[model samples]
Each structure stands twice: as structure tokens, then as C-alpha cells.
Target: EDCPHREKNGWMGDAHLAAEMAFYNYDVAHGYTKWLADIADEQRPSGEVPGIVPTAGWGYFFGNGPAWDCSLFLIPWYTYLYTGDVSIIEKQYPSIRRYIDFLATKANEHHIVAWGLGDWCPAKTETPAEITSTAYYFKGAEILSKMATLLGDSGSATRYAQLAEDIKASFNRQFYRGNGIYGNGSQTALACALYQGLAGEYLTETVDALVNLVKSNNYHLDCGILGAKYLINALLDNGHADVAYRIVSKRTYPSWGYWVEQGATTLWERWDGENSRNHPFFGDVGAWFYKALGGLRIDEDRPGFKHVNLNPIFPEDLDWVDVHHESRYGNIKSSWKREGKHIHWEVNIPNNTTATVFLPLGRQGEVREGGKAIRQSIARINIIRETDDMKVIYLTSGEYTFTFVNDQD
Candidate 1:
């Protein structure tokens, strides 16, 4: 269910679509724990989770698909990632394994999942469930493989990892068209492939195609709740964060800014705002804001924000940004502003946490911290890498302010 005006059910698609934003904005993992228990306790004998939790024997046959069911696999993994506790994975291990087994039985010879809704309410284009669902099938198996590895079950890990690769092969055989297109040349399919790491070798080509696709649409988002986050990631991960910003900053049709301009204070059920006035399905943009603009990000290898990657990408037109988050470790802050040819950056890394901070600078520049030379700033800051336009440094928990004088750019 999307809103109280509608079914008000616990829709898995809505849950997982906003999972990232939820994790970053609030301490929702504890609350999600009991809900995850409900989801597992309500798992069907056939190993499929219903579209709605605590259902009355509905949503299993038609309302739910792999995309919706992915919350079972994806959310637990995210829980473990955000909390660094294996208990969540352990609690759902059996159900996860059984669900993947059931999915394996459902796949056709070509390993395509054509069941359930596909790309709910995409703007102006159709993406098949066969493509989207199977893509999620690959993701579920891939995540299971990693979870198995974390649990010290080598056999299951190898089995699921290999199964994921086989599913990938099947997906490419059926859906991948030449030159980085997935299915029907839709943004949904392309963005899914890029987000799930399905575009293994043609990653750059796929990113270029997505960029071209956005350009063709005049920098407006056409994806639904599902593809929006991944589309943002595909661009940000491939060095086109500016393009992602351009898409989200639009205030015309099919853009969130358009909704804001219309005197709306709540998220709409659709881009056109034709139905419900409050919805959380399209909240992934909040996560993008923290990651891309605020320079706050988490690492899989170092879960629970023990260590972080501060890789802020500057928007082409926006000259100032301020971001802060209270992660499990402590408060993390990053703020930057451009003044003429100079940049004033301030950051706060809480105690007992370390951060890898990246500074966007030109080849020739002078950097000073606390009004002192960066070289004399401390025994804490160490330059790891420097290049023509950027510098990378390692920082232990502390508050810092750095000023960069633009000499080359």
C-alpha cells in the first residue's frame, strides 16, 4: 500500500525503494528488525513473500514479484551492513535460502522472471518484468552469496555466486542488445543493469548511453520509484554526477522540483501528482543528496561507518553545500563553498571514527588548514594521492577546516 487513502499495506517495493534514504536519515534499523521478523514469520510455504505484510492470503500470486520480494534479501543485508551484526542475516538465513531456491525453480530455461508487475508507473516507456525481475533475481543471488561468505559457509557461497553468474549469462543472452542497451532501450532497464553491476565490461559504454538518454529527454527523469535511485548511482559512480544533479534540478514535468513548485509539501504518488498526495516511494533522492552533495558515504568492507569515504562531487552551477549526518559511529559533517576562485571547506569527523576525505582542487593550488600550511596541520592528515585536479587524504576523527586557493582552475 502507498497511502492511507489507498490500501495502506506494507508494500515491499516501497520499503526497499526507500531503504537507503531511511538508513541515512534515521536510525530505522532497530525498528526494521521487528518488521523483518514479521516478513520472515509470514513467509509462504512456497518461499515467496507477499506484496503486503500480514496479508489475508492475497498479493502472493499477482501483486508481488522479485522486485517487490527483494526486500527479504536486500534489507537484511543492508541491516547487517549498517549495524555490522550478523544476527539479522542469521535470523533470515533459512528463509532467504528457501526463497532463492523457489525462484530458481520458477525461472524458465532462459532464466527470465516474467511474473509480477514491471516498472510500476514509468514515464513514457515500458520495461518488461522479464528484464527487471530477472535483474533482481541476479541481485538476490549475488547478495546471498556474500551473506553466505560472511557466515563462513563456503559451499553455499560458491553455489550462489556461481548461480548469480549463470543468471547474468542468461540475462545477457535474452535482454542485452548491442552497444550497452538492455531492454526496449528504456531508462529503467539500462539503469537496473548499471546499478546491479550487470553491465560488467561495457560499464563506460552503458554510462555514456544513459547520459545520452538523459540528454535526449532534456534532463528530465522518466524512471519510476524503482529506477530513480539506481539511475542516480549509475551517473554518480561513472563520473557524471553533474548529469545526475542536472536531471534532479529540473522543475518542469516529471521532476520532483515540479511538485515542489506546485505548492506541494508532500511526496506525490506519481510524478504527475494525479492521485495520492503523500508517498515515500520516490525518496531515494535524499540518499543521493547525502552521498553526492554532502560527501557522506559508507563502505561495505568497513560496515557501520567505522571508516567512511568522503567523495563529494561538485555540481556545475551550485557553488555551496552543507551536509551532516549522525551515523552509528558519530556525527559526520562536510560543508564546502566556492568564493570567486577559492573554496572554503569544513568537516567534522567524530571521535573513534576515521575518514578518507577527497578535496576537489586544481593541479596548482595552495591548501591551508586552520590558517596553517597543510603540511604542518597535524600528524593526523596524510596525503595519500594527488593529481592534476584533486587530492585524497586520510583523517582520524576530528573537526577540520581547509581553504584552497585556486591557481590552475
Candidate 2:
């Protein structure tokens, strides 16, 4: 259902675009697991999924494209990622393989999938459906490869990895127009490519293009639901979170802040606040608050809250963020405040769990925990890795407080 009133349907695109947000904030394993079975039951024998589940034989040939169809793969995958439940993946394996085969049937000779309702409801349509569709195909294949490895099917894993590589090559060849332009170089185009791992060697340029696009828009969002999911993370993941922070903080038209100015009680169906003013299509932005702003993250190698990753993006002007999630293991929390070149961070990891805490506090020697140097703070915390901008420390379940001061951090 998209809105509280009017035309609430089992739209597949809505499910996936918001899937990550849902999984991050709530415990939805059982519900999504059963839904996966029901949705797979609706899968056509031709390996195609209807755009809507529980359909009365419609949506087979209409509104069914890579973006909508990719939901079938992502829903279960997110379930596994958040819950560490392999049973759902096992249950949906056959259906998953069939869906991948269906995508193959749709791909062109160059391996690009050009069909789909792409970047649905764009603020200013720019990315070609083909670009997002093809990238999603690659993402689906890559996830499937990881699934195969988890299922002890090394052969399939290698096969799908190869397929994903082929799709990536094709996507880059067809869409990477050089100089960071992808299919007219809309914010959605650069963002989708950057977030989907399709940017390859041109990642830096792609981020620059996305940043420039947002700047050109006066820090307003030019993407709608589909591109909206990837846009923030793409910028944040590429070390340009300062730019991302500016975009989201804008209180102008076509931005979330404008919705606030409009006294929006909920997100609107469209950026301009037309149609249903309360809609879920663009609600995935909530996920960023928890993951990027709060810095609570997941480790693919240790799915669920079995292992946590804390990588906060401290906005330049924002004061602080406090976020916590009750994982299957226990409560996982991260809170941080910046004070004039100094930072105070507090983290709580649940019993029987561990975390890789990323502290972006300049050089390794400058960061301290409990009033001691990082290296001296352990028996519980260990400095596992360090880079120019961040010190990655591993710690066991417990409450920990860290402080660091560096103007350049």
C-alpha cells in the first residue's frame, strides 16, 4: 500500500525500495519470510514476477520490469542480511534462480536490460531505464553469487560472479560516456551507478558528477523513489557526505525540508506535494538516519547484528545523533557529538556480539578510549586496522566511550 487513502496495492517496487529501511528499523523476519513464499507462489512459470503480488492475473506484461522484479530477489536477501536466517534463502532458492534466468531472457546481446519503469516518478527524468535496470541485474547476480557461497554451491557462486562481471562490463561500456556522464548524467544516473558498483574505475568521477548535479540543483533532489534510494549513500560512501548533508538539510522546494515547510505530516506521493501527500515510495530516506547519521551498520560477512559496523557521517553543522537498534542478539547503540575539532562517541554492543568501530579522528595516536590511547584501551577493544582518515577498532560486547581531538579529522 502506497498511501493511507486511494489506490493501495501490493506494488513490488515500493516493497524493495523501502526494504532496507524496514529491516534496519524493525524485526520483520517472519513476516517477510512468509511473504516471500506467497510472492514466489505467484511467480509465473516463465520465470517472471508480476509487478504486484496476489494479482488477479494482471501485471504480467505491464509494469513488470527489472526494478519491480528485482524486489523478489532483494526482499529475501535483506531478510537474510538483517536476521541471518538462511532458511528463507533456501526456501526461495529455486524461485530466485528462475527470476535470474528471466532477467537473462530480457537482456540484450550486450547484456544490458533496457526495459523497466526506471527511477519511477523522477523529479526531472534523466537516467535511462536501461542504466538502472542493467545495474540492478548485476546487483541481483552479485547477491545471488553470495547466496550460492553461503549455500555451499561454489560452482553456482563462480558462475553468477562471472555473469555479474559480464553485466558490469556491459553496463560500463554502454553507459559510462566518460567524464562521469551516465545516460545524460542525471543525479539518478550517477547515483545509481555509484551505489550499484557499476562505476568501476571511475568511482571518484561519478561521485563528483553526482555532487555537481546536486549543487547545480541548488542542493535539491532531482531524483524520485528509485534513484532516491541510492543517491544519499552514493554520496556518503564516496567521502562526500558533507555534500549529502547539504542536500538533505535544504529547506527548499522539492526537498524533504520543503515538505516540513508545507507542514507535511507525512511524506508526499510526489515531491511537489501533489496526489496522496502521505506515500511510502520515498520513505527509504529514513534508513539513512539510522545507518549513516547514527552510524549503526551491518557486516555482510557477519549478517544480522552478529557483528556490527559503526561508520558515522558527522555532518559539519549538525550537533549530534543518537541511534540504537534492538537486534536479535541485544541492543546495539551509537551516539556521537562533535565539539570544535573534538568528538565524544558512545557505543553499546550487545552480549555475545562484536563490532568494528570506525573512528574518523585523524591519526591513530590521537584517538583515546576511556581517557587512554586507543592501543592502551584494550583487553576488550583491539585496533584491527587504520587508514589515513579512520582508525578501525574491533571490540567485544560491552559499553565503550571514546574521545578524540584533531582539527583535520
Candidate 3:
């Protein structure tokens, strides 16, 4: 219902809609991707798509149109992961390339692509000519490069990789703030660049800076909705999962988990850091907590790809943490027990590829997929040489049986 003017309002602008679909509540996210496909089809000669589609009576807030900024870079990646449709990728490549071309033209003399801060952090008064803008260009280049590799554009992949490298060099030279923080932009964006590998050698230092910044600034990064989602992910990916978890669990008036604790089904625009009653946006809330904090990661590299990494860290004292995810591959029903000694996971692999299960030490396991028995064994942990000589199983992605124990019989 977010993009109601398009005649098909069921799936439009429902970012958290994916979590619902994952939980088997409904397939609203799927429908939303369909709408994205429709919008992708209508790109101009420049291949740019509007960020928002206007609906009658929806007004400017609802009809913000497409963004010619970094947000545009996320479309192709999001599309592929949610739907696992490669044909769409091929169809959208030209438009994506046009976007790349636009960036190439915007590159500074140092070949760094600089963009004005758009739709990310507020109070980020720095103009387009600032470091955040260039960082945006760098981040976009990295994404486009990956999309190209996935689409079989080896030539373009190489080109974009080179461009990304150049941007990294430029970012460090121009944005690196010698005190372990990247000074080119806001702390959140800098953390993202590092976590996503866009920051190259600057990764560790940037993360250190972000950690300190959050702590010193009282965990308030002056971020908006768009920026908060990214900041959290960056923290998780860079091995600061604990720090990231704190933001979600911080009970201060505006922390992420604070809203959920307040009985909110969705997230607000700003946190209590900025204001206690500042709830401007409705669509932004539930989405981030479900995807990021929930640690719901779907590996889109393999379509109908049922491989998911379930690493959930529930806040202290929470009885149990659960997340339901939907993939073009199959359904993921998973939960975590913080107090449990061993990790437990159960999923239905999409019908087709065989699943290779990795068991934790001290936990012996047996699995049967499609009614066939699977054998298990042990291997050295953190060892240099590994052998698959331990165990093997064949599963056709549908329904299967999984049983494991802390002691081998």
C-alpha cells in the first residue's frame, strides 16, 4: 500500500514486507519486487529509475520519484536477491550502465566519484563537493562491479573493479582522518564503506573509529532511516556484532529495540537521541530490525539458493530469538537459543542442489533429506588442511529430517 497509485499496491515500498513473506505470512514482498520490475522497465535513455512513484493524492512525500544518487545503486542487488531473477538483471543492465556513466562524468579530477549527500544522514550539511558524495560514488562503483560479474559481463567487471580501486585510493588520500576514523563523511557512511569492503585497507581503522564514535557520542550517530540501516549492517559485518546488537537493544528512548519494546510494529524516522516523539516515517521501522538485527542473510549468488547463515544474538534475558525468511530458493524457519550450548538450525532446501551441512564440535548429527539417510563425522577446528572425508549427504530441496546431539552414540 506504500505505492498505491500504481494499481498494484500490495507489494509497493514494503521493505519489511520481505520479513513477512519469509515468515510465511504472505507473499507481499514478491509482489513489491514485481512493481520494482515494472519501474525498472520504464527507465529513460539514461537508464535511471525514480526512487518513488507518485500516486494521486499521495503528495510529494509519497511521490518522491527516483533518486539519481547512491540509493539507485542498491536496486539491482535488492532485485536479484529477493526474486533470484537473472533475466531482470540482463534487462536492467543497460540502465545500470547508464548510471555508471553518469558517475564517470561526476568523477573528481582524482577519478573519485563525488556525490552530494542524498537521502542518508541529516545534519550532514556537507555539500555534494564533500567527501560523503565521493564515498557514495565509490560505494556505487563497487556494487555495479559485482552486478556486472553476476551478469557475465567480464569486461565491464574488470573495468568497474579498476574504477573501484581508483576510488578507494582517492578515498583514503582524501577522506582518511589519521586518527583511526575516516574523515571524508559521517561516521555511519565511513563504517559502511569499510564493512562492505569498499574502504579496502582502511577497513579496521574505520571500524575502530565508528565504535569509538558511537560510544563517545552516546550511541547516537545523527543518522536517519536510510543511514541507520546501513550503519547497523556495517557494524555486524565488520565483526562488531556486539556493538551492533547494543544499538538494537539499547533501552534509551530512541534506540532500535526501544521502539519494539514500546510495542511498535514498525520503526520511527529518528531515535530518542534526536527527539523522543519524533516519529515521522511509518514504513521504515519494522524492516531494519527484521533484516539487520535479526541477522537474516540470504545468499543470492545461488538462485533458488537455500543457503542461509543464521547467526542471531538475542539481547540478554530474552527467552528465545526467531526469524522467518523467504527466498526464491525456499523457506527459512530458524530460531536461536542464547543460553543453549550448541547452535540449532532447521531449513528446507529448495528442490534441486545437495546441501553440505557443517556441524559444530561436540555436537554429533544425522540428517535425512527426501527420506535418504546422511552420515556424519568430525574434523579439526580452525585447521589449515580440511577433508570432506568426514560426511556426505544428498538432499533434493523440499522437506527433510534433521537430528543432532551433543554426544555421539
Expressed as tens digits, the lDDT of each residue in 1-409 for candidate 2 is 5665786677888888888888877887887887778789999898889887768877787877888888888988888888888988898988988999889999999999998888877777767889888988999999999889889999999999999999999998988888888887788888988999988899888788888878888888899788888898888788887777787788987788899998987878888888888787788888888888988877888998899989887766777888989889988989888887778889999998999888876653488888888788769988887777778889999998888864564
Q: Give candidate 1's error at residue 66 in angstroms.
A: 0.7
Q: In order, what lDDT does every prediction score?
A: 0.85, 0.85, 0.51
Compute the lDDT of residue 136 as modeled in candidate 3: 55
Model 1 poorest 10 in a row by lDDT? 400-409
Candidate 1: the clashing residue pairs are none
Best by TM-score: 1
**Per-residue error (Å), model 1, residue 166:** 0.8
Measured against the true structure, the TM-scores of the candidates, in listed sequence, are: 0.96, 0.95, 0.70
Give one clash count per candidate, in the order shown: 0, 0, 16
Scored by lDDT, the top model is 1
Clashing pairs in 2: none
Q: Name the better of 1 and 3 by TM-score.
A: 1
The residue ranges of model 2 lying beyond 4 angstroms of the native Cα positions read: 338-341, 362-365, 386-388
Error of 2 at 102 (Å): 1.0
